[model samples]
Target: MTPPKTIRAAAIQVEARVADIPWNIEHASRLVDEAVDRGAELVALPEFFTTCIVYDERVFGCSLPPENPALDMLKEKARRHRIHIGGSYLEMRDGDVYNTYVFVEPDGKVHRHDKDLPTMVENAFYVGGDDTGLMETSLGPVGAAVCWETVRTQTVKRLRGKVGLLMTGSHWWSEPGWNWARGYWQRFHAGNGRLMERTPRTFASLIGAPLLHAGHASVIEGGFLVLPGTRLTAPIRTQLMGETQVIDGEGRLLARRRYQEGAGVAVADLQLGAVQPRAESPPRFWIPKFSPMLYFQWYHQNAAGKSAYRWAKRTGRLRTWDDGRNARAAAERL
Candidate 1:
């Protein structure tokens, strides 16, 4: 079936707390209500809307079981508002955690896509998935992706010309703590900001599909690994790079909310259709060029994080969804 010529959609930007599930749910629900009030037929939330992803033990405790409250909220919201809704969350399946996106239709139909790869420190929490992000919905073909997946060439290669709409989210973050070499870090962040702002539109053009991108907007407190084999950690304070936005298949911006603007919803009428590709997929891995710092952090942290993940799993330090939820509930009563 052909999708409507145009549909109003919303991308929700949220200020989520690390390992705070109840607060995040309440905050995101309010934003979802705001989107519906503005006549959005479909609403998307940021990656890990239930809790911010960080290299902390509490973050592992935020993962949910397959049938959990976070997903229930999405389904309830979709049913209540008679609109499509979705976002990514950490899900535990087969004893491993995954960054999973769950999209729900009005009639209670559901679709899921696990992020293909974990980014940097995120590697410590979840394993990657192999499924294509494409889904056949009542509104036609829809695609889902999370964070760095939207910036990779392979993602475009898989979805280009195959979907009418691309729904994605990001948990992109700035460098942690700028105390040392402040000026250099300042310049680095500024450049990263420019790239974040351009990603949505550029990705739309490459995939030849209208895109909805939701993102997180808040500070994150966590620890960075000082080495690969030890538990020594350095304190890191960082902020999420929010670029919640909607853009056309031809790469025209329809609506946007920047990180500095705080939490909100970006609503717009999207012209949905698969159009002629505006840019060819490059023969490289990532679409955007990584700076030296980003390059080093990406490689180094990935190895370090993976090592930590293995240790956590073997030693039974990694919290299961049930274990985490019960612990949080018990704390609430205290």
Candidate 2:
């Protein structure tokens, strides 16, 4: 079947709460309905739409089974509305967790693409996946990416010429909590926010495809890990960088909803086809230039979070919904 020249798409910005799967799913569902009402044939939700990810221990409780409520909800919505819909979530598979994106088609077909790498403190909760983010949907060949993946050159390498449309989302948060250096951090976050606002269009230009990017928008109060394997933590209050937007293949912004605008949907009619690249992809790993602080945090937090993850798995402390179900089944057999 030939792909449509234009389709109405929506990117949903959600103010998701940490470790609250049920509430987040409900909130996202309402927004999905709103998008559908506005004639969105394809709806994309933010990364971790089922539950917000943080450095707290509660993040361990956010992992769901392969056949979980979040997946079920997407399937139901797609079938009910006869439209395509998707989002990423923390999923447990074979005792390991991954940041998995699940896309559902109107005919009930499902496609999955796990994030290739975890970002910052996210390393503590999930492992990276190896699949190419490309999916051959009924609509066309589409690429799926999560959070920082959208800002990486490696992602461009994988899907640049193969995909006609790029569907991506983020859970990107503000700078760390250091009240003593609040002034510096505030300025830092402001600069990063401006960069994030340009990311969707910039990335679209690189991949030479239209893009639909969703994101989270909310103030989060949580703990920052002071040490890898201990309960020691520092209070962190931050906001999500919600740059929900729709951009064309030529890097033109069609629609956008900023974080300060709160939770909503950014909907637009997109010309779905491959186009000439507007910008050359840099040879570096990251597409954007990172400050010294961000560079340090990226490496340092990655190591710390990995150490914490090892400790949690070794101690059998990384509990997930599948674990609980297995325990219940065992008890019943006994």
Q: Which has the greatest lDDT?
A: 1
Worst 10 residues of 1 by lDDT: 319-328
Q: Write the per-residue lDDT of candidate 2 for residues 1-334, one digit (tens) a residue.
A: 2354898999999999988888899999999999999999989999999888777777776799889888888999999999898899999899899999989999889999999999988999999999999999887898998889988999999988678888899999888667788899989999989888999998999988999999999988877767755656688888899999999989999999999999999999998888878899998999999889889888877887888788778888687855655776999999
What is the alpha-carbon lDDT of model 1 when measured against the actual structure?
Answer: 0.90
TM, every model: 0.96, 0.95
Candidate 1 lDDT by residue in tens digits, 1-334: 2654798999999999998898999999999999999999999999999999878887767788899888888999999989998899989999898999999999999999999999988888888999999999988999998889988999998899899999999999997875999989888889988999999888989998999999999999989987887667899999899999999889899999999999999999998878887988788999989899999999998888898888888887677667966776999999
> How accurate locally, in lDDT, is each candidate?
0.90, 0.89
Give stretches of model 2 more than 4 Å off.
1-4, 229-231, 322-334
State in Å the error of residue 160, model 2. 0.8
